[model samples]
Target: MADPTTPPEPNESVSETEIEAPRSRRRGILVAAVVAVVLIGLGVWWHSTYSEDTDDAQVNGHLIQVSSRIAGHVAKVYVDENQLVKAGDPIVDLDPSDYQVAVENAEAALASAKANAAAARVNVPIITINTGSNLRSADADVTGARATVAQAEEQLDAAKARVEQAEANNVKAQSDLERYKPLVEKDVISKQQFDAAVAAAASSKAALADSRASEQAAEDAIRVARERETQAQAMQKYAQTAPQQIAAQDAKAKQAEAQVEQAQAQLDQAKLNLGYTKIVAPADGIVTRKSVEIDQNVSSGQNLMTLVSLQDLWITANFKETQLRRMQAGQAVVVHIDSTGKDYSGRITQIGGATGSVLSLFPPENATGNYVKVVQRVPVRVDFTNLAKEDPNHQLRPGLSVEPKVRVK
Candidate 1:
C-alpha cells in the first residue's frame, strides 16, 4: 500500500493507457459491428431480391365433354374413372338396334326408289313407242281420209254427168209425147202409137227420179267422208303430242332418280348414325368422369363423361401485377410442381386481359361501401415444350398447384 498523497509508480504498459483507449477500442468494435450488420443486411436483401423461387400456379387443359349424339340404351362402357386413354379410343357403346333398323329401312327405301326409277326409265321407251305408233296411225288415217275425199268427188262428178244425160233424154221424150198427142187428137195417128208415146214419157219421168236419188246418195256419201276426215284430223292433232308424252315420261324418270338419290343419302346418313352408336373417341386423350352405366337409357345430347388430353397440357400461372411487369408472351418459363418436385420448361403463350376477380361471376364492385383495395392477379398461359414425350411421370394434372418462373432480359 502507498501513501495516500503520493502518485503511484506506473508500469510502462499501464502508463501508456488513456481514457481514450477504452473508448477507441469500443469505437472500433462498434465500427466492426456496424460493418458486419451492413454486410448481413446486404446479403439478406440480395437473397430476397434475386433468389429464384416457385410461384403458386395451376396446370390446366381442355376438359372435353363426351356426350351421346344419338338416343339409345347404353350397351357398354369401355373405360372407368381416371383411366388413361389415347386418341381414337372407344369409351362407350349404345344399343345399335334402333339405328340398325333405321339403316335397314333406309336401305329398303333406297332400293324401292331405285326400282321406281328403273320402272320410270322403262316407261319412257314404252311411252315413246306408243306415242310414235299413235302418230303413225293418225298419219295413215289422214291419208285414207284424203283418198275418200277424192273418191267422193269423182262419184259426185259421175252422178252429175248421169243426171245431165237423163234430163236431156227426158226433155226429148216429153217433146215427142206432146207432138204425138197432138197428132192423135187430130185422128191422124193410131191408138197404139199414142199409148206407146205415153208409156215412154212415164219411163223417162221415173228414170229422172232415180237419177236424182242416185245424186242425193252420192252427196250424202261425200258429207259422211268429210265428217270422217274431220275426225281423223282431230285424232292427228292429238297424236302430235307424242314427243311431249315421251318427254313427260323422261321427266318422271328424272324425278324418280332424284328420289333415289335422296333415299341413298338418307341411307348413308342412317348407316353413319348407326356407326356412331359405337362411341369411338375422336382423338387420343384420357378418360374421366365416367357417369354412364350398363343398360342405362341414355338420350341424345346427354353428358356421359369427359376426356382430358394429356398431350395438350399447359400451365396457368396467376402472378401478381408486380411479377408480371417483366413477363411477356413467348418468354421461356420453368414450372415447378408441388406434387412432384420436378421442373418443366415451357413458353409463355398468352396473358389474361383482365384480373381474376374481374372475370369472376360475382366480381368485387369498387363502388360498394365495403370496397377494399386488393392486389389483382392476372392469368398467364404457359405451354409446355413436349411434356408428353419428355416427362416420364406425367404428373401434371388439371387444377394442380405449381410454381412458374419467367425469365426476362
Candidate 2:
C-alpha cells in the first residue's frame, strides 16, 4: 500500500491491453444477448407456425339418461352411484306380477279366439252341403209333380172318349127298345126280346155315368198335382240360396279369424311389457346420479339415473377463430389433462359449424348496432386415438379441464 488515500496518476498505471480486454468483454456480452433474443423469437415463431394450442379445452363424453319404459313399482335396485356397468346389465327391476297376469290373460283370450275360428270354419262346409242337398231334393220334387200332372191330363182325355162311346151305345139301345115295345104291342114280337132290349139300354146308361165320374176324378187329380208342383217350385226357390248361406258362414269364419289375430297381437304386446319390466343398461358406462330406490312407484318415461360413457371420450377445445385458419380435420393432436398431469395422443375429428356463443341459449344480437366486436372461439372436436391404452384407469372424465395442441403442419 503506498498511502492511505492516494489518487492515481491519470495515464501512468492503466495499460492499453487491459482497457481493450474490458471493452471486448462488454461487446461479447452484448452480442451474446442479441443472439439469445433472436433465437428465442425464432423458436416462438416456429412453434406457432407448426402447432395450435388452447387451454380452453375439456373432456367430453356421452351422457345417457336412464328411464323406465312402463309404469310399475320398483322392486330392486342393482347399482349405486359411480358404479361401472356393461351394456345389457340389469340396472333396476319393476314388479312384474301385473305384466305376467296380463300375458296369461292374453294367452287365454288367444286360445278362445282360435277355438271360435275353428268352429266357425267347420260350419261353412256343413251349411254348404246341407243347402246343396236341399236344393237337389226340391228340384226332384218339382220334376215329379210335373210328370204326375201330365199323366192325370192323359187319363182325363181317355175318360172323356169312353163317356162319348157309352152315350152312343145307350142311344142305340134305347132306339132298339122302343121298336121292340111297338112290335110287342102289335103282337108280332116276343116279351123276352123286349125285356132284353130294356136291360141293354139301362146297362149302357150306367156305363155312361161311370165314365163321367172317372173324368171328374181325373180332373181333380190334375188340380192336386198342379198344387204340388207349385209347392215344390216354392221350395226350390227357397233352397236356391245355398251360395248365400255358405257366404254368410264364411264371413263368420273370417270374423273369428280376425279376432284370433287381434288376440295374438295383444299377447305379443303383453310379452313385450313383461320384458320391459326389467330395466337394463343401454350401453357400457359409469352409473351416476342414481335417483331410483327399492319399492318406489314410478311411471312410464320417468328418469331414473344418468350414465356417463368414459370409454368413448373426446376433447372439446375452444380455439380462437384466427387459429383455425390452418386447423382442420384429420390432424394429429396431443391432450394434457390437468387432473392426471398426463398427455394423451388423439386426432382431430371435426370442427363445430358455429361459435360457442352463437349456439348458446341466448345468442348475441349483432343487429342492435351497438355491438362490440369480439374474437369468437370455435369448438374443435379431438377424439382420443389410444385412450384405452393411455387411460386404462379411466381417470379422465367429462368436464375435466385439459390443454390440447393440434399440429397443423
Candidate 3:
C-alpha cells in the first residue's frame, strides 16, 4: 500500500476556475443563510403585528353551590366530597313525614270545601221549586177569590130584586084581603075568597123575609171573598222573593268554590314542599366542600355542598390595556394549558366592561395627591372552538393557569 496518512494525487487538468468552484459554492451557502435570516425576520414581524398573546390567563367555569330548599332533618346523605353526580340525582334525603302530613291535611280541606260547594248548589234548586210552587198557588187563590166575589155580587143583585117583588105582592094581597073583609060583611063576596086572600098575604111576607136573608148572605160572601183576595195578594208578595233566595244560595256556592280554590293552592304548595324533602342535584357536576351529614338539621337556602362543573369551561385572560387595542369579540385565539401541556383552539367571546382594578373590592382613586399611573388589565373571556377534540376528558377546571394568544388581524 502507499504511505499511510498521505495525500491523494491531483489531476493536472484542474485550473483556477475549477478551484474557485468550491468558493463559489461556499458563497452561495452564505447568501442562502442571509436570505433565510431576512425571511425569518420578516415572518416574525408579520406575526407580531397580527398576534396578541398573554400569559395572565386562567381556566374559568361555573362553580355552583348546593343548598337545601326546605327546612328538615337530613335522613341520609347520598354524595360525599369529590363525588361526580348527574343532574336530578339525589344528594340528600330529608324526613318527609311532616310534609306528607301537610299534604294530607290540604287534601282533606279541599274535599271539605268541594262538598260544601255541592251542598250549596243543591239548595238553589230546592229553593226555586218551593218558591215557584208558592207563587203558583197564590196566583190561583187570587183568581178564585175574584171569581167568588163576582158570583156573590150577581147573587146579591138577584136577591134584592126578589125581595122587592115579594114586598109588592104582599102589599097587594093585604089590600085585597082588606077589601074582601068589607065586602064579606056587606054580603058582596063569598067567605072562601077572603080566606084565600089572607093565606096569599102571609106567603108573600115569608118570601120577602127569605129574600132579605139571601141578600144578607150574599153580602157576607162578598166580604169573605175580598178577605181571601187580600190574603192571596199578600202571599204573592212573599213568594216574589224566590229569585232573591236563589241568588243568595248562588252566592253561597260561589263562596264555597272560592274556598275550594284556596284549598287547591294550599295542596299544591304542600306537594312542592314534599318534593323538596329530596335534595336533588340542579346540574351535572362534581360535589365538593360537603358540609352536611346524616341527621343534620338544615334550614332553607342553607349551603349543603359545593358543585364544580368541568365539562364547560373557558379561559379568562387579563390583557394589558395597550395589548387590547385591536382585540375584539369573535376573534380567533389559541389557549395553552400548562397543566396538561395541551394547546387548544379558541375564540374571544366577551370583553369585560371594567378593568380588573376597577372590579376589585377597593378600587384605586387617581385623585389622591400622591398618585402613580399604572397600566390597567382588562379581562377577556376566550371560549374553546374545538372543545370536544381538545378536552374530551374534561381535564381543565376553574382557576387553572393558562396562556391565551388572540389574533388581532
Candidate 4:
C-alpha cells in the first residue's frame, strides 16, 4: 500500500515454526500417501494368501441315459421332455401280451411236469412192494422144492433095494421048482411039491415087478422136483431184480422232477420279461432328450431318454496351473451360480489327475516343431454342502457357469 509495484520489507517478528509450516504439511501428506500404499499392499497380499477365485467353473451333475431292456412295441409314453420324475416311477410301457402268453405257456408246462413227477413218484413205492413180495414168494418156493427133491431121492434108493431082494427070492424059488420037477419025473417026489415051488416063483416075480414100478415112480418124482426147483430159481432171480428196477424208477422220478424245475425256471424268466415291459425311472431326475413315443417299436438296449440329476450337484472349477499352487482338497469354497444369482457353500473334494489340454480329445504335442508355451488349467471338483437346504428345488444343473472362491487357509 505504500508504493504500488514496489517490493515490501521482510517481517522479522515471524518465528521459524511459521516459516517451516508449509514444508511440514507437505511432509505430512507424503507420509500419509506412503502409509496408504503400504496398507493397500498388505491387504492385497493377505487376500491372495488366504483365497483363490476363478470364474472358469461350472455346475456338474449326473447325466443318466435310460434304455429299454427288451425288444417290444411301445404301448404308452408317460413322460415328456424336461419332466421331473421320481425314482421308481413308471415312465413307459411296452406290449406285455406276448410275455404274458409266454408266462402262461411256461406255467402250463410246469404243471404238466409236476403231474408227471407225481405219477413217477407214486410208481416207485408200488413197484418196490410188488417186486419185494414176488422175491419172497419165489424164495420160499425154491426151499420147498429142494426138500421135495431130497425126499424123492431117498425113496428111489429104498425102491432099488426092495427090487434086488425080490429078484433074489425069485431065483431061489425057480431053483427049487427045477429040483421038484426032476424028482417027480423020477417018481421020488409028489406032484404037490412041484406045484408049490412054481407058485412061489410067480409070487416073487409079481413082487419084483411092483418094486420096478415103484422105482420108476420115484425117478419121475425126482425129475418133477428138479423141474420145480429150476422154475423156483428163475422166479427168485426175477425177484432179485426188484432193487434195480426200483432204482430205475427213482431215476425216472428224479428226471421228471428236474423237468419240473426247468419248467418253473422258465416260468420265472417269463415273469421277469413281463415285468420288464414296464420301464421305470432309475433315479430322481429331470427327463431330457426323450426319443420314445407311443406305439413305437423299440429294440433292446435302445436309448429311450436321458435324465439329468439336479440334486447332489457340484462345481468343476478349472483353475490355471499357477492358481492351483494354493488350492487343495477339503478346502472351503464359495460358489456363486450365475443362473440363480445365489451363493452356495461347498468344499473341494478332488483334483483332476490330468490338465484340461491333456484330457482333450486332440491333445497338443510339443514335438510338432512349432510348439508354443501355454498355461494349462486343471479341474478341481467342489461339492456343495447342504445343497438341498440351500436350494430345495434343485436349481443347479450341469454345464452352468459359476464362480467359485476357495479359502485355502
Judge candidate 3 at residue 251 and give its lDDT: 95
lDDT of 1 by residue, 94-204 (tens): 989988999999999999999999999999989988888999999999899989988998998888888888898899889989999889999889999999988888888
Q: Alpha-carbon error at 245 in model 4, in Å? A: 5.1
Least accurate 10 contiguous residues by lDDT in model 1: 47-56
Over 4 Å off, model 2: 1-17, 117-261
Error of 2 at 91 (Å): 2.4
Error of 4 at 324 (Å): 5.0
Task: Give per-model TM-scores.
Answer: 0.75, 0.74, 0.69, 0.73
Worst 10 residues of 4 by lDDT: 6-15
Best-performing candidate as measured by lDDT: 2
For model 1, state the Cα shift of residue 158 in Å.
4.9
| Model 4 TM-score (2 dp) | 0.73
For candidate 4, list the clashing residue pairs, or say none.
Answer: none
In order, the Cα lDDT scores of the candidates are: 0.85, 0.94, 0.90, 0.92
- What lDDT tens digits, residue by residue, belong to model 4 across residues 1-409? 3766655445433555677999999999999999999999999998788988989889888898999989999999999999999999999999999999999999999999999999999999999999999999999999999999999999999999998998898889878888888798998887787778889988988999999999999999999999999999999999999999999999999999999999999999999999999999988899999999998999999999999977668889999998888788899999999999999999999999999999999998777688677989999999988898999987778999999999988
- TM-score (C-alpha, index-matched) for candidate 1: 0.75
Per-residue lDDT tens digits of candidate 3, residues 55-98?
99999888899899999999999998999888889999999999
> Which candidate do you rate higher for TM-score, 1 or 3?
1
Query: For candidate 2, lDDT tens digit of each residue in 89-190?
Result: 999999999999999999999999999999999999999999999999999999999999999999999999998998999899989988888899988888
**Arranged by TM-score, best first:** 1, 2, 4, 3
